[model samples]
Target: MKIDWAALGSVFGISLLITVALVALFTLGIVGLSRRERAAAQGDTAAVAVTGAYACFAACAAAVGYGIYLIVA
Candidate 1:
């Protein structure tokens, strides 16, 4: 059997990028929540921070759900 080196490399590249993106997104969510806590301690309204944190979490969840769906289907 012949190995399809180009296809293998392409899949590897895509997977690597997606993994990095997901990790970065999760990290941003954590950082956003941490910033929100700091802002609260300083008595500042963390409206933007709160929104950002939630949005990041939601996106991560959606991505995970979609991956599961793809696997199942």
Candidate 2:
């Protein structure tokens, strides 16, 4: 049997890129939370930071859900 090396490489590359992007997105969310905490400690409003963090988390969740859907369907 012949193996499709190019297809295998393409999948591997895409997977690695997506994995890194998701991790980075999650990290941004964590950073936003940290900023919010710091702002709160200084008696400042952190509405934007909190909102941004939640948005990041939501996007990450959506991406994961889509991936699962792809696998199942």
lDDT of 1 by residue, 9-59 (tens): 999999999999999999999999999899989999888878998999999
Decoy 2 TM-score against native: 0.96
- Per-prediction TM-score: 0.94, 0.96
Give the runs in model 2 whose Cα sits over 4 Å from its true position: none
| Model 1 worst lDDT window (10 residues) | 44-53
lDDT digits (tens) for residues 1-73 of candidate 2:
9999999999999999999999999998999999999998999988888899999999999999999999999
The regions of model 1 sitting more than 4 angstroms off are none
Error of 1 at 15 (Å): 0.4
